[model samples]
Target: MRRRDFLRTAAVFVSGASVSLSALEFLDPGKVLAAHPQLRWAFLVDTHKCVGCGFCVKACKIENDIPLDANVTRTWVERYVIKKNGETVMDCPKGALDGYTSKLLDQGKSGKVLVPDKEVAQAFFVPKLCNHCELPACVQVCPVGATYQTADGAVLVDRQWCIGCGYCIMGCPYGVRFFHPVERVADKCTFCYHRISKGGNTACAQACPFGARRIGNLRDPDDPVAKTVLNQRVGVLRDEYGTKPHVFYLGLNKEVR
Candidate 1:
């Protein structure tokens, strides 16, 4: 099917009021909640206070038991610090445990961190993962239907059905999805589906010391995500791609690549 057609069909399937177990039994609601007559969850990451901390990254690796050398990062932070000469720079240490250490080390042994010319200029860290787009590219490109998007705006991979084709990896515009060298299957952030459906928050959001990450139902006006999006001028990455990503960035920097 064409990418647009697939996205439309998937959205309709998820927006349904109820889904039969027989149709969804192959899917693990615990592993990836489907669209049902219930709540939906969305996430928001505040760039204003992220501080490039890799705590969330560490938590994801430890909680999921992902290998230390795996190039397929489920979640990671990118530090962007503009130089005084209008030279914009960015970096993400392969597996930095902490944001500060990664940023400081990026300056090399001299430890001369670059900054913008302005005395009180702004610099921010953006922790990126699967945006869980409403019209997910990964789902559209999955030949075996392994990658799917839940109604709650989460992009998930079915490891059992995955053929290790790596199609989703190429389809994802944000470069979030990756192939697990060991499992030989496609994997990405599930928005911690197991925890969110059971009245809990995602591990990354829960571990955030600055409360920079917030998860909530986008359909609910009272939810923090909804409120933030409504009140702030937030933006999603690669908006022109028409992916309709659910992850919103608060106080996004103009220098965001």
Candidate 2:
């Protein structure tokens, strides 16, 4: 039988019990990669289009089984206000689930109160999530092999295998990883893998009225989102880390980190 097919059959029988870390080692992703050649999922964020409505944040929580009141989230949005003097203020209160209703921004690293609108030169919203890097440090730091990269380039955690050592959480440079309050395992965005794998859009993308968040198959030359990344100028957060993050941003501001 083909390797991919064999793994599928093995998974069926193994579903009755927890799969051990050593047993998972035999499932070479490289061999199974041939089963999916044209399915590299990519995500895009248009800063110019995002309105900070928090609809995407609410949708992600509902779709991913995250508690509505939980402080943690699979995705969140940040509001950035740049002052005329080049001072930047950012906030993501309640993960932007309530939207930016308050004119007063939180005192983040700046430790300063929100400046007056007259002093602000510009303002925009930035959405943040797991970058699903091509070279995922989280996967490498998982001592029990709980975190891994899929053939489609998604970084995922095997909750059953995870020992909750917190290594993967620390390994992430983007500070996206967090310990699930209930599951007690490392949790982060999966690019809505369960939905996207079924040929459906992510809840965040589907709920977005402004089309700020988008997803596409990078391997498909004709894919609109992929075409944008290929043809248009895009930016990524913390390129200095050399993680090769898959999430790209359009209209990325110099002040944004």
Candidate 3:
């Protein structure tokens, strides 16, 4: 049977949400290879294009069977406000599942005194995810070898083999890794491997109406996303770590970390 069709029939539920059992193939050893062996996957985020709508976060939860009310998520958006005095404030309320409507800074959220709009220099939203680095620290630190990177550059946690030791969580510089609330295994972004393998976009990318998020095969010369990455100036998080992150950002402000 076709992989997609078979996956549908093998639906499994986690935390009352239905997910395809086959979608977690990295858990099944010897099946961790990418569907498109020649493709090197990468992700792009346009900071200017993102509007803090949180649609991506909501769609990711539904597509991945993550509990809606869970405090953790595979992806999240952060709002950064730069004060005229050169101080920066960052906050992500409930992983930005609800759209950002508040213009005023919340002391409770940012752990600082509220700054009047007149004192704010600029504000923007940045989406965060597993960078799927070329040399992923999560994969390097997985004692049981539960965390690994697929050939196409997607990082996945083998839920069945994960010992819940939290080593991978601590190893990640991006602060993207977390223990699955239900499974208690190391969990992070998979780049929506299940959907991408079938020639579909990541749930977050698909749900984004503003064209803020995109994914593509970096090896494909004809791909628009790849061309953009090759031609345009893009920034990545924590470049000093030397993990060589695959996720790139356009119009990234210096205030961002």
Candidate 4:
């Protein structure tokens, strides 16, 4: 079997066993408090430098041990290209799984091999993942109280308490929530809760080769993330949804569709 396939199988087995390993102890509660020293959690994604390599996706699956058949992708990359005059106009494929090889932009399509346009002057990639909202609708709409915002502002789900009602999935405006097929519960990015609370950055942020993703305490004025939000033209996805997400995007595509 391929290395990735092997890892997937192993992760499934490990996740199955982890279901009963002391919920409170499985993830260190104190680590979250110790990591930042301040009570805040936020992520920043820059659209300009993403290369669409899909490494983040692979890393997330390996790090979280998500099942292969499951569609509960915690992180993924999206490729968007704008065309005009029946020719390749602009393209930006800034995720880890970008299929860019070296072809005309017009030939780019879904699930097919994509080649970057050598002549195309503007093309980039954007990585998409859980925004970890501050006022997450998933947390608010959970009738069973399985989802809740942490002290650091990240929205988290308690698998042990979740009833698999799919309420959180429907409540999310950005469609970031997903139900795990094997676990039979709602799952989403915890900002690598296991890692973040342990004085380590999230897998996606660490996996990024170009430093496209940044995580830090929003409460700290001196932190890079906090300063960027204050000084940069940052944006959040679907802000009108009123979820008040903590994740911010920089250098967003003007023609993103």
Cα lDDT, all candidates: 0.78, 0.90, 0.89, 0.75
TM-score of each: 0.78, 0.84, 0.83, 0.74
Candidate 1 lDDT over 117-220, as tens digits, reads 46324456888888888788789988887878765566788889999988888988999887787777888888888988898888889989998888888778
Please state the error at residue 224 of candidate 1 in Å. Answer: 1.8
Which whole-number lDDT from 0 to 100 does residue 142 have in model 3?
87
Q: Which candidate has the top score in TM-score?
A: 2
For candidate 2, the per-residue lDDT at 121 reads 94
Those runs of model 4 whose alpha carbons end farther than 4 Å from true positions after fitting are 1-37, 85-121
Q: Report residue 234 deviation for candidate 4 (angstroms).
A: 1.0
Best by lDDT: 2
Ranking by lDDT: 2, 3, 1, 4
- Tens digits of per-residue lDDT, candidate 4, 104-207, equal 44324753444345434455666777788767878888999899987677788898999999989998887778888777889888899899889898998898
Error of 2 at 65 (Å): 1.0
**What stretches of model 1 exceed 4 Å from their correct place?**
1-38, 102-120
> How does residue 244 of candidate 4 score in lDDT?
80
- Screening candidate 1 with a backbone cut-off below 3 angstroms (N, C-alpha, C), the clashing residue pairs are none
Tens digits of per-residue lDDT, candidate 3, 1-257, equal 99997777666433336556666656643444444456899999999999999999999999998898989999999999998999998888889988687765445634645668898899899998889999998899988888898777889998889999999999999999988999888889999999999999999999999999999999899998899999999999999999999999998988888
